[model samples]
Target chain A: MASMIVTDPSSAAAAVHRLPFARFSNGLISLGRFVGPLHVCSPTTTLPRTLSLRSPRSSRFITASMATEPSAKVIDGKAVAKQIREEIGADVSKLKEAIGVVPGLAVILVGDRKDSATYVRNKKKACESVGINSFEVHLPDDAPEEEVLKFISDFNADPTVHGILVQLPLPSHMNEQNILNAVTIEKDVDGFHPLNIGRLAMRGREPLFVPCTPKGCIELLHRYGVDIKGKRAVVIGRSNIVGMPAALLLQREDATVTIVHSRTKNPEEITRQADIIISAVGQPNMVRGNWIKPGAVIIDVGINPVEDASSPRGYRLVGDVCYEEACEIAAAVTPVPGGVGPMTIAMLLSNTLSSAKRAYNIK
Target chain B: MASMIVTDPSSAAAAVHRLPFARFSNGLISLGRFVGPLHVCSPTTTLPRTLSLRSPRSSRFITASMATEPSAKVIDGKAVAKQIREEIGADVSKLKEAIGVVPGLAVILVGDRKDSATYVRNKKKACESVGINSFEVHLPDDAPEEEVLKFISDFNADPTVHGILVQLPLPSHMNEQNILNAVTIEKDVDGFHPLNIGRLAMRGREPLFVPCTPKGCIELLHRYGVDIKGKRAVVIGRSNIVGMPAALLLQREDATVTIVHSRTKNPEEITRQADIIISAVGQPNMVRGNWIKPGAVIIDVGINPVEDASSPRGYRLVGDVCYEEACEIAAAVTPVPGGVGPMTIAMLLSNTLSSAKRAYNIK
Candidate 1:
């Protein structure tokens, strides 16, 4: 897959100029929506344009020549996530000072999987960083499913615990849906409940909590100032946690979204038509350079493990996208490790804090 | 809206041959699917084609000479609905004989809008026609919201009540969401339950009951043998009950779907891209002939009251579509009165029967 790759900025720009791609973009992303028309010009002729809508009075536009290098700008997810944490920390402190209460998140981990444990640890650290209290309950893989449900019920009744998240991929012996449904919807920080997802999909309705990973993906796009409304977006893979919800969030932002999976025919053709591409399929380097449209923005949500002899671990992590090739074609792209992963925990903290605020009747 | 209309069979055929309209059509209309590639000859030289996929043994392709006249086919929803009810009646009898079980539907009506009463009456009559038992609780305009809730609680506990539907637009005093939420999700025959809709949007997740009207629209297409896979379908409007769910269903069936709503710009251009169009907006005659592509299959769900004092009723029904114009331009179209309306009730009965079957652990 790596050897068959190629990338060219011109073809991608031409793809963006096509009908539907140009006509469909509503350009109303959450934070950094563009104002006026999207000027389509030769790459060198047009200055890099970024118009941000942080607020009515704070809106800013910047136009600068990018003559130094042709490579795309790296979207810094870590910095954006840190910025969000600062905002959340401020909110958390205000709530604590006014109400004499601190937001608390309870995590239930049922298995001994290394990666799941690592995720739980990271979430705990993130909560502490943002001034939210954290609680943990660990059980062995052989623990009865009822044991997990028991913990959830107790936490639901505990007013101190504003949010409860049962880490996923429970033992194959357990029913995933039943356990997920057991977490009371109000305390469901993971946002895996079907009701929350339903609200997210509908207009004029609000979900109690947006699933963290998809929320993080959208936050990254907003942070980097990508205009989404009416733009053609292709979401690769359709996992419940990331791809599916990500597509729904994009659609809510008014982007014309397509979910391409294994069954979809001419996946590359459809994907190339997108102005924004979000690849969450867990396949390593599955998206080659030619498959991308130049001037497109990419958010890579996939993190896969591949062999690397030089590393002491003998294996290194890579995203679903071929990062090296994507950077050449895309105008903006998120790197694998520092991109969506950090934002997920940040979103979880945000959800937990919001749940606490709601519980205390505080804004 | 009616005077400028023109429908040419030749032009419609030529339009069908242009791109995806022909390729996307599964052509499985109740009659037959096309046997070979559609020949784009002049309408005068060849006969009208009606390909249907009613059954493997019943498949037929007619290349007859349509030399008589040029007009679009009127899809009769009333007749199709009657056919569905007959099938449900047979299944209901079989369930009774085999398990001594009969399907029951419970309807809760608050307040007395004349239109709401008419709809409830029509539903009761339809229930009787299909051998399904109907239960109704009508509350006066001044009834406390709790009275409605009390009735829903009773119906939720009643084992015999296999399905529950609460008539919409309750009195201004009643909290609509609170009352609707009281209906046990298991008996939510209207499929308005958030969980049901959430499941519908997720891949590999099946909704317990698809909302009735949208379900009926899909059934009409299937009964008529419209091939949806790979087709470009546009659903006009984004109401939760009709247009939104319709778009989700179309996407589930492998069609590339676009939802055009009030906020949408250049909606006409997007609508023309569809080989199949389902318009649920109640705006009478909003969809004009030129807004449509030639030879498209249409399912019109709007039932607006239009003044037509020629006879006794003083007013009559119309669809979002300009019926006279659509009949001329479209290859096949559903008329306002006899099209999508009947199918909605039929679907309700179907859902109730399925619920009873599922409850009784019968296929």
Candidate 2:
């Protein structure tokens, strides 16, 4: 189970402004975006006395609390993504009017995996929504590896294309490293190139582009006014795409970072000491309430699907952290379905815009 | 006070098989190497019960202990580096006999900085000691940047040169990044290239060459039989050359690694949790006895020079850890002058040999 956010473009549009709310069996209403004065925590409860009001811009709070069980502030990635798209759209328009150039993104999809195809389609739609040009190539499963390289080569020479993305999970016969390396560093919007990662790891150096998922994770933290410097941050998982880069990013922000992987012993003990935790291990409910500090914030990148007999699809999406348990313990948390998923594509658009600006020598 | 071990070639040859020993005023004889103990420890002292017998091959132990203050086993890096050099020398002879190829390393020294010249001379000497061919090119302080690039290009084309190292702290007029990046990744034995670093940071990917100092730190752990897997490791400082790479290397060995930097708050609290600690920050004696966890293995990479009125040179070398304090607390500790210093040049020789083997396609 990989905790990556690859969502359909249509679903992203539909999920906007939807509040994350939970109703308990004890007749208690837990509103994720509730605001205004109301009954705070009961004095007799063992819950932490200090309530963390994270969203200063939104100014939301819990309306009522019948039970002592506390609720975490929802990160609301979908809403945040909506605002970012709007910002990008306005910038795209201004660039077009001033420089008479539209940012262009080129994507190459090798195989016909349903999820991969959906991601490509969503990416193209996202480009269109932000007034950016999108170029795509669909190759048959049996297509030769050279064919994919040819497309990348052509895109590399194309001045109009600012960003290039190769949809992953290439055919087994294809060498992913060779294909990925073929894309020029300037147009590597996906940022999987080792050069970008190397630059990111070193101090006094800047990567041309940060990986989209991790960038979105940091964006959420920045938007929520979370202080990263001098904080203890624990990142679960050591995956090349997400966890490793996320840890590096946190370290760059001056957060003393530790990564917990499968080989880590007593992970909960180390994780509970963190002021902020980023769980990208994809294991559903692996991070329990006890694994988090009382006021710690959680950004759950996992969107794992567990079997659900009552749901129409026979499965329901869950995050690495137990959402119910996290609400009662953490200061804030990102939901599995509507959280990091939408932000991934939004960051892709932003990267494309930035690349175009650099190409045209525009700020 | 950077802990980088830059020594003169003549001095490297002079300092061999030197044992680390400490004389205490408590009438305690602390011998770094004492095979067959006279007395273990007094039963009244508050110390860890389990004694760490690290050197199985050497079968060395503490010779005498008068007071309750227990002494740590010295890592004996000078002896370890000598062993490694002997192994590398034998391998170089075998490869030459088998394939009729001798490994070669090229050193480019810019400017007249005394320290930089000493490091280059040491590297050349070390290469010769290991039966590898050495090439040297010295440029004046005011040499043009193009001259350096020309030398790099020539070496890049030279089949005899398997590894190319450009001495760092190039003149202020030259761009370090551009000059470092000029050397092809294939011959980047110094391993400062972003591509090499990118590979080192990612999982399932291997860098052509690991940086010398950090590689030596890990080699010390492996030689001493210090367990790394499933252990908690802390790395002080985050410099690209040492601290950062050291943390990544520890992570690769399956140790949960945390990096503490200058901006980190309450560094002692985190450092005390590590089973193994590698201090690379140049600050002299910054990590005191209380900062180390009892029974932890310490690898000190800092070789800082502090003022010493009594010394002939008016200075003395110390490490990031307070040596006297660490000896009483840590299970084992590497000494400043003889610890990681000698190992760096040995690893450089090893990298050059490996590069030659790869180039010739020899097993």
Candidate 3:
């Protein structure tokens, strides 16, 4: 009878340790009788509002092996991104078929940094993939600021272009804010437009496009079933491009988001306590295994080029984390070349598709 | 040797328990030795730039008691605000003296909400106190939207006006965004303008003025030696006025900021882990002592009125936290009326001063 008192394993251990065997058994049986039937029906869950699988389909940009022996579970970014892109592509098709217009994405690339050129190319490819018309306006390295403004004015007046993305790290002399601000907010699909960033930061108002990379990072977490609620998240590097906005995005997700920068004292100690670590510092191997907590989810956004004599290019793409060590300690990890990079372009397409739908008033 | 391990009783027990006892003791002694000798010739301790006092000076509108208590530390809004006003007043004087120009603050107060009127009156008084000429345009409750726009346009073109504030809760019928955005970014002292908000949210860029109340809350924390780096901060409420902006400002301060709104589940459990809690839910006594971590700093921005027959007004101002319980458990807590409310006006004056300085080209 006492042995019957023990119910759950932990409680049973406590009951057995504190009470006589007959008393414990009796308690267990009573507890089991009271709770056993409850498991047959259901655990409470908040039902989805629409029961619609209408989220943007992920687009798989590049396939990288995610399975490892035993240490960490791979968070498959390419697969997730591909699925999102497919969903967005489907929506883009729906909008085009329903309405007479298709979403057009305009890219304004100033100067020719190889990296910037690559991004623009990727964006164009993504646009084509998502059924969005791609428009490119490449200004020379020394184009007049007035010319850029004129282009923006043209796009602002064009009803066909739903989104405009000005490649970042503009020529050193150009006033980036003035140039970015020139884009009509409706077409500022990069979400760099002040109105949109303001809306993203404001409560009750959602941005039409939460900047692609930050959006991608959050999407990765959501698809992976990471519980952001009440979890400590540490974002390293406070670059305008990634870290600061990413922190804001994480805060909206209900994770306590700490942004550690170069000025931060003992960032390692702070980072070690985080359930989630997003490093955008672009410093190779800056986040060591010792800096991470066991079972922490690591998202390395740094795409640093490290010297690799074996490679013909003399450098290979590496991440902020020492990948080998991180894998051993982390519960989940994202690979660099295939992780956040591809997802950003996918999100760009998703945003463009949404912009198209909103412009045409197509559901 | 064992006696050498002298632990300071004031150190948080949690911190002491985490590190080895000997290392903690050795570190303490080393810190003491390092600090003691530096002050022998020069008694003044040099605070780091991060710790520099950016607190606003007191305004002429209201002043609270200057009492220090053990349970709660005064936020000293008056002192901080006074410093800010002095700087602004000086700038205003320079503007007038140099270019036959004076900084003008235009306030648009719509409707006769008693609270709104009081706030407007206080803001006008603040404007005058800082040597800025105050121009007020009051619209009747039933005034047409075009009238408000007309007033905004007038202020926008007025070369004399350096800053503008449109008191909120405009009649339900008016388009708030269109009216607010009418103010030129240079004169948007309240910093609610979309462009200003966008600038605030971006990295490597700053808004001309941050929204006053949130800026004040963050200034209090910065002045009080509470380090935001890597700390868990919970912001209650999600209103554009206070909570959302406060979370953004805190994120800028590098704290792990979590936002809890009406939709959040188990807010108490979330708030309990906060190293710093900013409650602006406008619900009297919504947060109890159990919701706060022991020794956590609290900034209560709520100014709700609860029935109190004992008071002459038949109601008493109560904050989001039950002050009685909060004072006992929290390291520091701001009182309902005297804390954030005064700081807001002070920051407004600070922004006004900044505008005047920029307008007049005064250093």
Candidate 4:
């Protein structure tokens, strides 16, 4: 993956001139033309044209002049997510002002998985940041199935709680299906509820809420003006959370999606054909630089820990793809820690808000 | 597609000897040795293979050599479904004998689509055959929303109606989602109900009633000893009825499944890589011989109409894949009208029977 960065002023101007306009909103096209520097336009003449929805946007984006700054361009995921959160906050305030009610999310955490606990805490904080109410329920590691069902029953009965999230990987002894089924369909904020999954798979039908992480990945591409319609998208890994549903969502967006998993032989051959690659395999650096096609938009979903001598924790967070190599090849790449991770909690808050609006007939 | 009949017994025997025996069941291996004439070994050599559980008593089967005499080796779905109905009738009788309760199915038809009406009538006949009561609700094409919801509410409240199926493709004026959502998940035997779809998509989760048609396709392959695990499967079309959910189900079986749809360019190149091809595209003869790999098992789901002057209906049923060409290049193929079509109705009856047993708490 060899990435070209245009840091020169002259190249930016040329890049701005080459941008195709139709796929972009009127405001974005004007913004690029007005704000682009001249040096960045140097690479514009050399960039090849494409048959894509965002081709116009891409043309203006390619400046021949490489970025002089030697330091790696750190993707500011936290900042992007924060901006989205603030917008949502404003929307929440308006919704509340109009309806006299705020969105409420009820999270049920069974057992004591450290990761699950951390995720729940993050969700609650995110909810608070967006002016949504957060409700928490923690059960003992050895809690009876009936007791957990009782909690779901209570949540289902509570009119105030508009959405519910049951932290997954419950105790081995308890029936996870039974507990999950107990959550009312309207309040299933996590979107893991069967009804939601079913709706997602059906054509001419849409899920009330798409799962947060996958939705966030698409949102990132949409915001950055990546064209998906009719592009070949290769999704690596097929877990229920990220891969399978993500592929379905991509297909719905009119992208021809091919899912490759552990069973796939010569995955690289299949991946090389993709205009967009979303690798969610948790394996460290499973996707090499050569595996990616040039100018492809890469979204790395893997959050793995690699041994690091410099870090006190003895490891550092790394994605499924080798970031250093991928940076050079991909036109745009989402960094592991900052990219998809933060957007998930933000989307959860969005779902919670939407859930409340629907429940109370506020919208 | 060009199909060659196995007229040469010796050549057929040679092909049987070359099939991968390491993946075959012990019983099949033993059956292969005793080839007097018309043994199951011949077609088994060409058919797709998958790992499946079966009771020892299920070993009773006719050989492929017997397949030479069409009557001897055909898997009689109509007869089998009749036998199954008789068995269910006995169970229904026992429920009445012991508990004095009858199992019933309520079908709601919102429009006058000829196909939907035929299906509803067939289901009612099947219910009668199995000693289960049938409730039918017919609405005009311009029926109002309240009228449909009222019927759903009444059926949901009635304990007598154990299962419900709202025929699909409602009039354009009607809201399909709202009507389908009204069906109680417990009685959603059609398995289009969102909860069932969700369970089907989730890993390690089993749908209470797998969608009838796709389930029938899998069951046929399983009974015939087609290996699915780790096999490369290409499914054409991604409609909700068959392709999408079928791909999900195949993935659950550990097969690497790729879905090719209308948006898929160079479909032949992708499909040629499949060890098994399941084509549901209704376009007659869309799949050609070159598109299929040698010795791949082809499951043709499309029941298309082709001109046939001699036929009473002025046409004959065809499939997306050309039967003649596919049979010649592929190891085995399912005839369109006879293959998947009959199995679908059989699975419907199976679903209804299961629903009855569950409702009455009968084994």
- For candidate 4 chain A, the 10 contiguous residues with the lowest summed lDDT are A1-10
Q: Which one is best on DockQ?
A: 2
Candidate 2 lDDT tens digits, A89-126: 99999999997999999989987778778778778998
**TM-score of model 1's chain A:** 0.81
Comparing 1 and 3 on lDDT, the stronger one: 1
Flag the better candidate by lDDT, 1 or 2.
2
User: 2 or 3: which has the higher TM-score?
Assistant: 2
True contacts kept of 1: 0.26
The residue-by-residue lDDT of candidate 4 on B250-339, one tens digit each, is: 888867777877666667888998887888755556676778786677777765555556867555656667766665556557775577
* Regions of candidate 2 where Cα sits further than 4 Å from its true position: A1-46, A49-69, B1-46, B51-69
- Lowest-lDDT window of 10 residues in candidate 2 chain A? A9-18
For candidate 3, lDDT tens digit of each residue in B240-279?
A: 6677778778767767666766545557877887889998
What is the fnat of model 3 with respect to the true interface contacts?
Answer: 0.47
Instruction: List, for all models, the DockQ compared with the true complex.
Output: 0.28, 0.69, 0.25, 0.42
The CAPRI classification for model 3 reads as: acceptable
lDDT of 1 by residue, B263-286 (tens): 454567668767889987655566
Each model's backbone clash number: 22, 2, 43, 46
Span of ten consecutive residues with least summed lDDT in model 4 chain B: B5-14
Interface RMSD of 2: 0.6
Error of 4 at B312 (Å): 5.2
> In model 4, what is the error at residue B85, expressed in angstroms?
6.6
